[model samples]
Target: MKKFPEHFLWGAATSAPQSEGHGSLNGKSPSTWDKWYEINPEKFQKNQGPEHTSNMYENYIEDAKRMNDIHMNSFRTSIAWTRLLPDGKTINPEAVTFYRNYFHELHSNGVKPIINLFHFDMPWWLMEKGGWESRESVDAFAFYAETCFELFGDLVEYWTTFNEPMVHVECGYLYGYHYPAIHDLKKAVQVAFHTIMAHTMAVKAFKAGKYSGKIGIILNVSPCYPKSHSTEDLRAAELADLLNTKSFLDPAVLGIFPQKLIECLADNQLLPKVEVQDLHLIQMNPVDFIGMNYYQPRRVQAPATVNHPAVSPADFYEHYDWPDKKINPYRGWEIYPEALYDVAMMIKDQYNNIPWFVSENGMGVADEERFMDQTGMIQDDYRIEFMIEHLQQLHKGIEAGSNCFGYHTWTFVDCWSWLNGYNNRYGFYRLDLENDQRTLKKSGIWFKELIDRNGLL
Candidate 1:
């Protein structure tokens, strides 16, 4: 253990839909994600659906107490669009009260609450109105953001506009992870443009509200690594980085879309439809801080074949990789701890050292129940190792002068994943979905000690 910053926020992060059960608690509406779940239940790994367990909107006070048990200094939970603005045209005060009280409870218990505006949960009403495709939706999103800042900004000091804009593009357009799934390059370009515009708009609203708080965007920056020094490989890696990470990072923080990205879109005539004033707002309004969610480094390599079955030549894959990368056996995602170092350093150098936080990072293990064995609790040692390694890398970057201010793991409790649903557990406290019982795993106890020790090696 080591002493770091006196105000370091060591905590856990979760989203409204992922942790909040969709159907129960009088919260009803077809979110883009919910519709996706209904249409393709088989898409999930074990027939697990989003209908079951999400810790909030169901067991708020108890779960808040569970988070207290883990001894976290902070907690990050997203405000669901469909929940807050159930019909997209109006605000739901009841929903707002539920969330307001939740945060008030956390604050009362000494946990700082970082509220994020969006987490890929688009209201179905908006989706039907062409979702992020129409510029009108951008206006609607901006208004909704202002409403949130007015209502909650007084108590919650940190506001995040969107979580993982790249994943939003990939899921909604390029790949079919979530709803309004489309694979058209033209549509993808439009959607990316709108998402950035929405983030920029949110920043504007936050500043306009005159709220005394840090307003920023949460980017799931999967640091890109090339396979080799070969020119093509390096080029491929850069393209991937531009598409996945830099697409939003540059514009929202740096206040300009990556030129390479703009050129790529222009070359294919897939350039998004932009209005006269949208560019101005994006360029002038930059975030006060950045919230990053890094689960793993993205290792891409040269496309095996040209003209992907899903995307055209314009949508080709960029080759990138870290040689001899370790794999998180349980989650099946590549484990490159050093990427966190590289990402932090790059953010300092690349984004001008904006204050940042590891808003979400954790390993997703399967059948964690088996780890209990004869004991009553599950001993998730692998998750402990994964987190420690990442933290070590983070410490290295911090020592080297990166302005990373905090670390919050993916979740505080074992809860529902998107399509994977309740199957993938990523919490320090494992929740029995069947009985709604909470048990502290070894990682939970370890995190408490880490909080007390101030740091861990």
Candidate 2:
């Protein structure tokens, strides 16, 4: 087994809304997720909402102890916007004290905290005011970012401006799977534009204030592979890449939108309205690093029949399931471990080999309790295999000069998902919702060994 770099980060990743319960406690206001669940509880699996999950809000000290028990040196999590600034304008003192204490606890346990500013839990007030689609919301987010830097910047050395901004745009605007579910291409373009602009401004603010840490954004980058060698298939794959990856990647790393994407947006009259200085801001503030969340590759082919111009992104290309490919039956996503290597190589060749890490990569299984043995532990050997294969590919990327640094799985403990609720569990520690007891899964114990050895066995 190959050893990871001595300084490679070994930890688990989680988000606030997903892990932290007590949705409306201690000066915490409702976020978009809270509002969405209230209005459409049926949309969530088992009609569960974010009101309670892992109870990290009250048990973070114990959680930090568990993280240390696993020999984790770093942990990635997000602070809820509503928790920090309930109205998106004023800072909540109670929330601030809670976060300060929580982060301090992590540091006391020798765990480095990588905090994200936004993780799709937008303040409900902001959503009512047009959210990221409005320029005003962008400015508000910049203010919120600056405040976070001033407050918790001393405790956290790694800060991410946004976690999977593209997912929010695509799921919320294009596919209508999230809150304010609107299916408008024009709105999607505008939302994406503003979201990136917000990231740009946040990065600029972080640098200008001389914050004591590095700042970056998390992108879920899935390499697109054409189904065939034909020009039509290639074009379809390129379009898919443009929409899914480059739309955010080009701006964050290259500091400019791809010319092809710009031309396409112009052709469709879907170009977002931009201020004269917005481009300058984006170009001036490229991120110091990037965080990639890779799950699967996109297999695309040219559409058999062109849809009308009014069609959504789904109409732009046809997705084909590759024959003979391994699939995660529980999540319905292809299990292509080699795609990690491809993504890393793409970054090396195109993005100047900026320092990056796998911010998220894991498999979620439904009805995970069925895998639990009589020992009262989840015998998730399948998850162990998943992690080993993915890490092996990541090791190959590192050896091939990818400049990758770390790999954090999707979650540390079982928690609430936005729409899926508790249907899919992706956790090292299994949370017993009935009793709020957390027990280490077999994969968690294996991860501890892997980290202690600094390599796979």
Candidate 3:
């Protein structure tokens, strides 16, 4: 049998936009997602929009109970910037009251709340202000962080500044997927730089206020594995890791950017405009810790051609599709549990063993109703196996001396995913979209036992 550390945090992660509905209610301003869905409904699958999600805004009381029932000690969710400041600057009294009550409910039910400040749900007003491409938005985000710390600082002990910010850079600026979609290398680099600057600014504010709680950032730290041991392959993998993984991790954890990454940008003429003291601020405001969201490993090979009309990461490396790779057919993600151990060791060996945790890991299955039994509960045995396999690897890393403290699944309930909506379900409790009902799935029952034992046998 293997066991995690005492006081191990066992919970699931959710986001404000994905789980909390009431997009426009209670004096809430429109978020980028709301406006994007309104303008381009056809872009979303099944014409689903962000108007009505899992309704967590109204069902938080019972949702907290569900978390406690499963012995989940810590849960991570974001505070909607749109809700907190409806107009992007003025505080909304109604939103403050609602969030106050929701955090109180979690505490009353014996679940500790881990509140994240931003989860890519930018306020519509902020978006119109040039979003991350402008430094003024960075100041706005720092102000938002300070406001959150003051408003709910007493309620939350664990605070995160941003969640998977790289996604915002890639999906919105590089790829045409997320809201405010644009494909420009210059904008992408600028967005990445401003995003990190925003994080450091938030960290500076958090430290300056002398908040009792710890503040950090959540990054999707997917390790890049080379297809072969050849020099070209290894170099390609390193570049991929530099661009995708360490670009944010180094700045947040180590208070510096990778020199190689800087050189890459300089050589390509894609360097973002930087202020004279921006690097100093980043160097001074390292996070207290970090949250890592690992779902798949990136396999890369040296690109055959480096010629391009404009600078792009694709010119440096190409994705290598390994034959016979175990994959999650539903989500189209590779299922490589060993990558968990690799990520843990990377943090231990390369990043001075910073305090971190698995913030998001789960299996998303499509049309989960097919697994429901006669009792109307989802028999998600696959999810159980997935977590167990990943946990086993994580336990190995812990025993070998990784400063990991927790393991949070991707979600607690079936929340609405971006574009995909609720088609891919990843939750311990199945949420009935029709009636806003939540039923504990088989994985939830198994997880309770695992939490009680504090180990796997």
Candidate 4:
């Protein structure tokens, strides 16, 4: 077993809307998710919504203790925008107290808290006004960022401006999976541009406040691979990469949009409206670090026919199923551990080897209870194997001088997903939703030992 660095962050990552239940309770307000679920409950699998998740809002202290028991020296979690600024303007005092105390408890327990400002749960009021499509939404997010730095910045040392910004843009605007569902290519481009601008503004705010913390953004980066050596397949893969990876990566890290991507968008009349000053802000306010969420690599093949200019990104390329590829049976995602190593190499060669971490990486399973053993604990050997293989690849990346720093799995406890809800479980600890009880799965125990030894065993 290879040992990780002494300071390597070992913990779990979770979002507020998915984990912290008690929606709109204790002076909180509705997020876009809450409103969406209310309007169309059928959109969520098993009809599970954010109203009552894992109860993390009230059970954070106990949860922090559980995290400590697992030898988690660090944790990454997001704050609910609606809970903090219910009206998108006024600060909720109760939410402030809750977060301050919750973070204090984590700190007191020898656990470092990595906080994120946005995690796809925009305040309902903000979403009602066009969400990320309007410039006003950018300013609103800046104000919220400033307030967070003032209130809880002291408790957090590592702050993230946004978590998976592309997911919100693609899912909500292009694919119509999330709230305020719209399938216009232009709106999607506009939303994505505004999101990047908001991130830059927030980064500026965090630096101007001079808080003793480092701020960055989290991106889900899945490098695109061509199915064959043909020119069409290569072009298709490059386009897929531009849409999936470089769209946010170049702006965030390089502070400039890729010329090819810009040309493509302009040719299609899908270019986002941008101001000269906005470009300056983006170029000047680059992130101090990056958090990467890796799930799987995308394999692309050339479409049979070129689509119209107004086609959504999803329609721009055809996804290829690699022949005889291993798969995650439950999630239907290709299991390619080597993609992590490829991502690390790409970062090293193209992105100046910036400091980064695997912010979210884990497998989800359906009907996980069927794996429980006689001892009343889930004997999730599959999860353990998954982690080991991925970690081995990550270790190789570090050996190759990739500057990778940490590895945080998808979640700490079983919680609600956005569209999938609790249908798929991806957690170190199992949460009995019916009883509101928490139990350690075998994978959780394995993680504790791994952390204690600071390596795989």
Write down the lDDT of every candidate, Cα atoms only.
0.81, 0.91, 0.92, 0.89
lDDT of 2 by residue, 1-457 (tens): 7889888999989999988898988889998889988888888888888989789998999999999999898999999889888887788999888899999999988899999989898788888889888888888989999999999988999999999998889889988888888888899999999999999999999999999989999999999999998999999899999988999999999999999998878877788999999999999999988999998889999988875553677666889889989999878999999999999899999999999999999999989989989999999999999999999999999889999989999889988888888888999999888878999999999999999899976
TM-score of each: 0.95, 0.98, 0.99, 0.98
Steric collisions counted per model: 7, 0, 0, 0
**Model number with the top lDDT:** 3
Scored by Cα lDDT, where does model 1 land? 0.81
- Predicted structure 3, TM vs. truth: 0.99
- For model 1, state the Cα shift of residue 225 in Å: 1.4
Q: How close is each model in CA RMSD to the real structure?
A: 2.1, 1.0, 0.9, 1.0
> For candidate 1, lDDT tens digit of each residue in 379-412?
9999899889898999889889899889999888
Per-residue CA lDDT of model 3 for 344-443, tens digit only, reads 9998998899899999999999999999999999999999999999999999999999999999998899999989999999999898888999999999
Worst 10 residues of 3 by lDDT: 307-316
How high is the lDDT of residue 374 in model 1? Answer: 72
Q: Which residue pairs in candidate 4 have backbone atoms (N, alpha carbon, C) closer than 3 angstroms, thus clashing?
A: none
- Considering only N, C-alpha and C atoms within 3 Å, which residue pairs clash in candidate 3? none
- Which one wins by TM-score: 1 or 2? 2
lDDT of candidate 4 over 1-457, digit per residue (tens):
7988889999999988888898969888988889889999999998998999999888898999999999998899999888988887888999999899989989987889999999999888877788898989889999999999999987999999999998998888877888888788899899999999999999999888898979889999888888898998898899999887899989889999999999999889898989879988988988888999988889989887776784766556788999879999889999899999999998899999999999999999989999998988998899899999999999998999999889999889998999898888999899998977898999999999999999875
